[model samples]
Target: MSLLIVGATGTLGRQIARRALDEGHQVRCLVRSSKRAAFLKEWGAQLVPGDLCDPASLPPALEGVTAIIDAATARPTDSLSIRQVDWQGKVALIQAAKAAGVERFIFLSILDAEKYPQVPLMEIKRCTELFLAESGLNYTILRPCGFMQGLIGQYAVPILDKQAVWVTQQSAPIAYMDTQDVAKFAVRALSVPETEKNSFPIVGTKAWTAEEIIRLCERLSGQEAKVTRLPMNLLRTARRVARFFQWGWNLADRLAFAEVLATDKPLNASMETVYPVFGLNPEETTTLEAYLQDYFSRILKKLKELDYQATKTKNQKKKTSLRF
Candidate 1:
């Protein structure tokens, strides 16, 4: 089978490519850069140069492809709106795939896309999911829980800081998944008959709270880091301040953070279901101790460079103020 993976350079997309290749499928990556495609090339994937918003660039890649995994994310470089990428681009891809005689459409959706209306990201994903279901194409929807990578990617600030303090409402337990698991599951869904046109949820081994994640970091780092829950009013105020400083975070994202913190939406997916369907057994994930170790190890390396630069500046600041 020939599979075209959009967003092939991304974390999840890369993992999907690896798994697909291991399963003896010819994998073609749709990447925006030849440089980014190099790694995929090294991993034995053929690069199909393309972008989501540019339909003219995509048709060449879609030719002779059997399936498509629409993993394209909206980035700052995108001239199109989120609607254009998530909805309009998705619709276009479906039409192109149909024209190319593609068999399956694998969509990456979020949990409760409708319930989380405050965040435009979630809303966009939900909108795309709707388009896929109605497109008359065979589709498999994988609604993953929060990604563990988000800890490093989106929420890197708190994870890097000495004290991991987030302005969340309260520590709400969530079922997060490693991107590796998501990739494996994606491969299974693409190859296995049972998962076609089915909606499956992939999550962590166990549900963990934000506070627990902080504790895990502390344990991992072997450092005493506090998890302080900020007041909702203060969080809202801080978000406003953040926005004033040209931070592009939406108000809805802030509210969603609040909702997760305040409420207990114990997500309803189990490893039991995932193991049998995908032949995957959950691993003993890092508790607070292990996470902090890896987190701080990387953080300290960056901090050391900053400290060295600061010291160099101070050493050069010998001239005294001449004001009498």
Candidate 2:
């Protein structure tokens, strides 16, 4: 079957593409840029360039497409809110798919989209999910836990620099999923012939409190890693500052802080729901110690690369000024 993966270059989306390609499935990916599409094509994905917000650009991309995996993520700083992408964009994609005679719509969602009210991101997810349920199309929804990758972004410097990660008391007990695992489950959801219409929450192996995670890091990395529990007040103020500078910062920060941090994490969200369905179990479960060691190592390498690039750029600019 020809599968169309929207947002094919994103963290979750790219992994899904990789899994699908490994299964010998013909994968077509919708990318926003020619550069990205060229890169994905080089990696063996059939790349179709299109924008999610513009409906007029979709039909050609959807032509002869059999299924869609909507991995599109809305940034809080986006001019359009989640309603635009999660709700309207999803609806448009579904409508276009149905119009094009495509069969299935698989959505990548978050756990507790409906039950959670403290975060706008969840609220938007809930809305899109509700719309998908009522829509007259074959659908499967997958809600994954917080990603280990979410912690790997360049901004995670504070945690890396100190050889420790700070957290509020809420994230004391945290359970997050590896992005690779989430992608595996998404591929299964797409490949499985059964039309299961239930929302499944995918999680990783273990949940560790911030302190426990730090202890693991210290043990694994052979470094003195400390877990500094910051006051809620400081976190909130930081969030406010982020919001002042960015549009989606308020919602994004609130969601991360209120929803994931201040909560009890359970294994229920992990591969338990999906193991039997996918006929696959996680063989490599990353322990807090192992995960941190690898995570820190990667960040250190990236920092070195970035510093080298910046120095090169600065030197080139200085040479240009000297020539003038």
Candidate 3:
């Protein structure tokens, strides 16, 4: 059976494609350009060039595909709004997929999307979920929590680099799941009979707060890390100023994300119920510490390589100057 992975160029989408390919499944990618998705082609993924925003471009991408994993998302910097890509685009894809006689349609949504309708991103996701449910195709919705990659990049990396981790407010504990783990669950959902027509909240085993994360960073990196908290009023003012200027990107999205973090709420669901459906164990999920370690290790390796290159370049310049 062939699978079509929408948003095949995204971080999560790419991971899903790689996982499906490794499992010996025939994978196809619906990409805007085959040039940008050359890596997917190298991984043996059939590339179908199309755009989610353009409905006319979808049918060709959905052709001959048995299932579709909808992971496409709108860029905050793009002229496209959340309504366009998250809702309209997805609805268009669902319609196209249904007409194409696709059997299963899998959607990647945000965790607690319905509960936080005030947030534009969540509202868009909620609407898309509804549209997919009524699309008459066998559907599975996977709502994953905040990714470990996101937290590591936003919070942990700064600490490792001896910079402060900034926050709008003290956040509650969040169970940040690894994108790889979520990808594994998504691929399993396509084949698992019990997962059909159901929505699963996928998350990691442990929950962590901003303070705990900072402390962990100090422990792991052996460096004193500072935490800077910004007031909600200040954030709101900044958002307003950004909106007035018609900024390069969507500042409202950033503010909404910050609001979600500031409000003390649990972003994770019980993993006990989720792991069994995919025949996965809690221990198998990547933890915050594990993610931090791997992330910093890579950063250090890259810095070392840069240093070596700089030193080699200096030696070459010195030799040339001496000859002159």
Candidate 4:
């Protein structure tokens, strides 16, 4: 079957494409620039030029495709409005999907998006979920709490580099699942009849707080983290400043997610109902500890190798100078 993956170059979307390709499915990626997504093409995915912001460019991309997995979200640094891509553009994509007679529509939404209607990105996701549900198309909505891939840059690399790791009033515990695991469900959803028209919350095995993550990184990297805790008022003021400019709307929408930090609740859900339907094993899921350990091991090993090479070169230079 031919699978069209939206946001094929994104963190989650790329994993979905990889998994689908590995399963021997014909994979087509809806991308804005084939030049940038050339790596995916090398990985055996067909790239179709398309943009979520451009309604006219969607239908052609969906032609002859069996299903769609939309893992696309507007980035904080994006030039376009989140609403334009997440809501309006998605609406156009859905309408076009229905018109194209695509078999399944898999949507990746944020957990508890409905609770934060004030947050532009979350609200857009919540609305898009509702739209997909009522669109009369065979659909599966996967609400993932967060992605662990974000931690490498957010905490791990920064700790290794001795940079400031930012935190906040941080009350919410998040079960940040690996994007690869989430991708498995998205790819399997197309073949599973039971998953049609259903929504499931996909999260990590355990939830973690900011302090816990910082400590984990410190232990793994054997380095004390430089922690920087920003006040809620400061973030709010920054968000307000961001809203004043058209280019800043993306950052403003993303900063609104800080509301999660103030909430008492954890952004997580039980997989008891989720894994069975997808025919996936919970034990096989990647844990936060294992993920971090692997990252640190590979990185530390590379650093040690580089240091050895440098020391060897310095010693050789000294021996030659002393002989001369």
Find the candidate with the highest TM-score and give its number. Answer: 4
Model 4: how far residue 289 lies from native, Å: 0.3
TM agreement with the true structure for every prediction: 0.78, 0.79, 0.90, 0.99
For residues 1-324, write the lDDT of model 4, one tens digit per residue.
999999989999999999999999999999998898999999999999999888899989998998999999888888988998899989999999999999899999999899988888888999999999999999999999889999999999889999998888765899999999999999999999999999999899999998999999999999999999988899999999999999999899889889877786899898998888889999999999999999999999999999999999999999999999
What tens digits encode model 2's per-residue C-alpha lDDT throughout 1-324? 799999788878888888888888789998778785676787788888777788988999999998888999776556665666766787788788878988888898877666666666777788788877887778899877577776544214444566446567665354677777777777787667663677777766776566665555555444564566667666666666666754655454444535446656542455565677777766665544556678768866887899999999999999999999
In candidate 1, position 121 carries an lDDT of 70
lDDT of 1 by residue, 1-324 (tens): 899998888768888888899889999998889896798999899998877777778789998999988667665444455666776777788888877888998988877677766666777788888778887888999887676776654244555555456536566677777677788788778777777777777777677777677666655545665455578777667656655533334442434446544656765476577567766555643332344356667877878899999988776674333332
Please identify which of the two predictions, 2 or 3, would achieve the higher TM-score against the true structure. Answer: 3
Q: Could you tell me which 10 consecutive residues in candidate 4 have the lowest summed lDDT?
A: 163-172
**For candidate 3, lDDT tens digit of each residue in 11-73?**
799999999999988999998888889999999999988888999999988778999998889
Off by over 4 Å in 4: none
Query: What TM-score would you give candidate 4 relative to the actual structure?
Result: 0.99
Better of 1 and 4 by lDDT: 4
lDDT of 1 at 311: 89
Residue 319, model 1, lDDT: 39
CA lDDT of each prediction against the hidden true structure: 0.72, 0.72, 0.84, 0.92
lDDT of 2 at 214: 56
- What residue pairs clash in candidate 1, if any at all? 170-261, 216-288, 217-292, 219-289, 220-289, 220-292, 220-293, 221-292, 221-293
Which candidate leads in lDDT?
4
Residue pairs in collision within model 3: none
